[model samples]
Target: MAQITLDAPASHAPVRLGRLLTIILAGQFMAILDVSVVNVAAPTIRTDLHASGAGLQLVIAGYTIAYAVLLITGARLGDRLGHRAAFQAGLTVFTAASLACGLAGGTGMLIGFRFVQGVGAALMVPQVMSLIQRNFTGAARARALSVYGAVLAGGSVVGQVVGGLLVSADLFGTGWRPVFLVNVPIGVVLLVAGARTLPGDRGEQDRGLDLPGLVSLAAATLLFVVPLVLGHEEDWPLWGWLMLGGSVVVFALFVVAQRRASAPLIPGRVAGAPGMRAGLVTIFLCMGTFGGFLFSVALHLQGGLGYSPLRAGLFFIPGAGGFALASLNWRRAPARWHRPMIPAALVVAGLGYLGLEVFESGGVGFEVAMGLAGLGLGAAFSPLLAVALTHVAVADAADASGLLVMTNQLGQVVGVATFGTLFLSVAPPTGHALTVTCVALAVTAAVGACCATPLLRRRG
Candidate 1:
């Protein structure tokens, strides 16, 4: 329980940021990749395991809800322990869980192991931001954040593409299992590299963990996520509605508890940091829209249009190019331009989605339209995080990062639940589905733009 200040003095040698980013991003890529990678393989998994629709839903939702629920506590652990130590611990858990997921015998075991993997991800991910805050400053920090954003956004594409390849490859006749098993060797290498390369900074050991605040927040998140994830699949039963209502009440209780706790899970000052709240709202909107779009499009292409999994993933390739172009050129803009970038990008992305309507007749222009959408995604993706944390205190980086990530996961849940439902209701000739999803995304982007307007008025 000793506090170790690992930030070396000014006169000491500086660490290479590249080494740090590589180590952190490698672990993060693994975690983020898992989120979307499993999607393409869902059908294969169901066939191989004889999973029902509801059961398959659980397999996906379990990881997401658990990851969202435990994120704040994981952030606190990083603050109470060293970010480096906490990250390493998370990596170890995640790597082991991935192996278990590959080796699972049935839907129940895979779902259980997926939840454990979420816990590990919760522990590892927040520290990536905290470490960037701890090590980088000024323009260097901006660049680092931009890269982080790019990687985070790009991970989805990677996951979809890689998942398709893995499922198709069926390495050693393992079927969908290799998609997960591939992580083992990569994780082992990253774990070793991270331990040696990351700085050894310990947190305040004397500060006790806020047990009550933790419970309330966990309950609040679970209450919100579990219902949305299961409600539609379960046909919106009464208990799900009750849980949704209960989440609101529990969340209020959490806020009250946090206000009184001596060492609160998330300190008020940090939560109230300038631009932080607005940034979080913007992130929620953007991520939610993007998540919904991805989920709906995947289903439409595969289930409705009858594209092969690989072809379905390839349909997204144009968007990836657009994103890459935007991210690569992001640093060229002035600081003042950052705030407006998100809203503008959303508009562009929205228009791109709207363009898909034109391709409905023959699906001829799908790739081109998606390319435009990807461009919009690229422009705003990193800036969303950059603008959100612009004024956050370094000390609270881990907590803020955890909260930001949780919001993102929640947004994705909402997107999937709401839009996924919409897609399912219509079914076939997915042009209508595309229109519905695009309109919703456009509206969400507009909301994000509105939230970001205040941040734009403030100095960068």
Candidate 2:
């Protein structure tokens, strides 16, 4: 394969185009995989690293916070420096951080490394979407987007299953370390493949970094995420409340800073766009419920039902299949279906949850109900993503992409907090609490459906 140099045009021949897509998609798979893989490994990590409940929560929250904070900046940088350069640089950072995570000695070390890994992921993730817009056009671009959505959904399911297998296998007695170590071989292959196949940077050299906006945004995220993770563990301490309050203030300040900054981290016009605004809100609700459902389901299967991690992961396979099927046919689906699909998918997902609440006895019926939830999720996510990004301008594509990613992450954080809090507040045994959590999650999904209906109508 010929190396694609910095000066090459965006066009690709049929043969090379296949390689380009492979390189881009591989990077994307790694990014999405990181988000959910850790859930399966959390128990092992807690046992091995002697992580407290709080420490375990940080392991997840830290990564998400760093990833969310840096995403917009990463997108902006990509736009300024060229998507390919940003993508490669991001991949390199992510690979190194994964190794750091695998080698870490304690909970603190793992949390720190995870944060760094998220920074790299943030840098790489936005580039994936930007690359699609840059490299493909018209129907081809739409096709690429569909593939991207499928990969996103598929990667999440694969993460849980793969993490379970790796943990259970305990290859070389490394236990959960395999979850992080596994990325190295994959990353090496991606790097070599990307070097040979990815398109080069297309932007001019003079674009500068937005340091001030980056700092404020990071501060704002820490204020928001740190409090959420700590609040429940500490029984909502004063500092937690203070941090939550401060987050609002810092976010307000960040908004003011962005308005004044010449090179804002998030372009104001893009943020203000009606489609983007609706998209971000929709993503927040959808991802929040999705994230909570996954977390709750994992706990239900493992903690409540006493299933092994591998078995728990297997339960999600049907749902993953359903999502893949829906995504494959999404293009052929009518545009009118788009408006109603959001609510419909939510209703299905909610009913799946309701079924769990009503019929669950830790049996085959429970697993079937869970699969239905996945089917609903699959039906909802791709179409929703398409609707969200539909009206974004090409020039602001990277920024818009970053914002969408941020909302998704934020949704996960909020979901975990809201649902986790509800489950914990009951102070019941693990099994009962999980059941109640599923019910609460079902109700939340129903609310999401209601909110999404208006957006669908607006889009229609």
Candidate 3:
């Protein structure tokens, strides 16, 4: 806490924050990048492996499903194992999995390794927020989190470009292999740095794993997410709807179990913090919109307009730039802007989504609109993240971090499923489907902003 004070040595504080953030965010970016990077390499993988359509889909969905399932448990593991150890162990697993994926000989092997990669990501990524929470506060925390937000947006953009470049280059004639191989060295560097620099936060005093709470929540999440991830691909089969419906029942049981537990995984006090729940809701909506936009726009560009996957991905750069610009600088705005920032900025994002209808796809107008959406979306994330944690006690930061991230990942899953399904099922024409999906995305943003407005206004 003393490090956050104005009186702290400027040089020391920045040096500490810089070293920690670089190590933590590099790992974070690596995990996030893998989520998108593989999509670009999918075609190449299919050709090389002689994969079926479903096998190819698994190569992509497997990582996400595994990642979603284990996140909260991983965060709790950090508390038990210590943040640094969890991070190192997780990174090591992730890096090894990356290597395995690169060398995978069959479609099944690649899919299996990809899931293992997700397991690694789940283990490592949660520590990032806990580390930030443990080490920084006040304006320092804000700046650190802003960079976190920037990474969140930037990773997806870079993944597309990097994936495109690596696949196109066929570096060493390895084709899509470099995308996975690329993480090997970066992971090694981060692992070494993290072992030295990451906070060795003391483990919580003898708290049991809270197995009942952990198992219940993990089950609820898996039941919920599995349906969303695979359902649309299967054309929303009856089993998908059944699983989706059943997740609610399981989640309700989880809540009941948590109430009875002495040491709940997510504490009541933390979850009940002012603006905490509301902030999570806002985050869900905003991120869901982001995920939806990316899926629909990329699909439109590549499938509908006949652009190469590389070109489709390239167009996302302007949007990524917009996101980085707004996320990095929004704190400089007047204090009053802080409270209204989340929803208000989200409205700007919605306007950008709507702008797609007014402008041609991949044109200057489209790029500008995409950038505007990115900027607005970028500005919105960090503030809500702060608000969610703003009232949380320091002791619960790790738990809070996991819940926040789990919610965010789930939102993206829902967004992509909902938007992608809408795009496919509603409008038969590619152009019409994009316009309709954009309109829907714009509407979701507005609703999210409206819901977020009151909590932020009163809280700020």
Candidate with the greatest TM-score versus the true structure: 3
Give the per-residue lDDT of model 2 (tens digit) for 149-206. Answer: 6777778789999998899899989989989988898888888978887888776456
* 2 against 3, candidate with superior TM-score: 3
Q: Candidate 1 overall Cα lDDT vs. reference?
A: 0.82
Candidates, ranked, TM-score: 3, 1, 2
How much does each candidate deviate from the true structure in C-alpha RMSD? 3.9, 3.7, 2.7
lDDT of the candidates, in the order given: 0.82, 0.78, 0.87
Error of 3 at 182 (Å): 0.4
- Candidate 1: stretches off by over 4 Å: 1-15, 361-364
TM-score of every prediction relative to native: 0.94, 0.90, 0.96
lDDT, candidate 1, at 273: 83
Pairs in clash, predicted candidate 2: none
Q: What RMSD value applies to candidate 3?
A: 2.7
lDDT for each residue of candidate 3 in 69-125, tens digit (9 for 90 to 100): 899999999988888888899999999999999999999999999999999999998
Best by lDDT: 3
- Candidate 3: segments with Cα more than 4 A from true spot: 1-13, 458-460
Q: In model 1, how large is the Cα lDDT of residue 317?
A: 74
Span of 10 residues, lowest total lDDT, candidate 1: 1-10
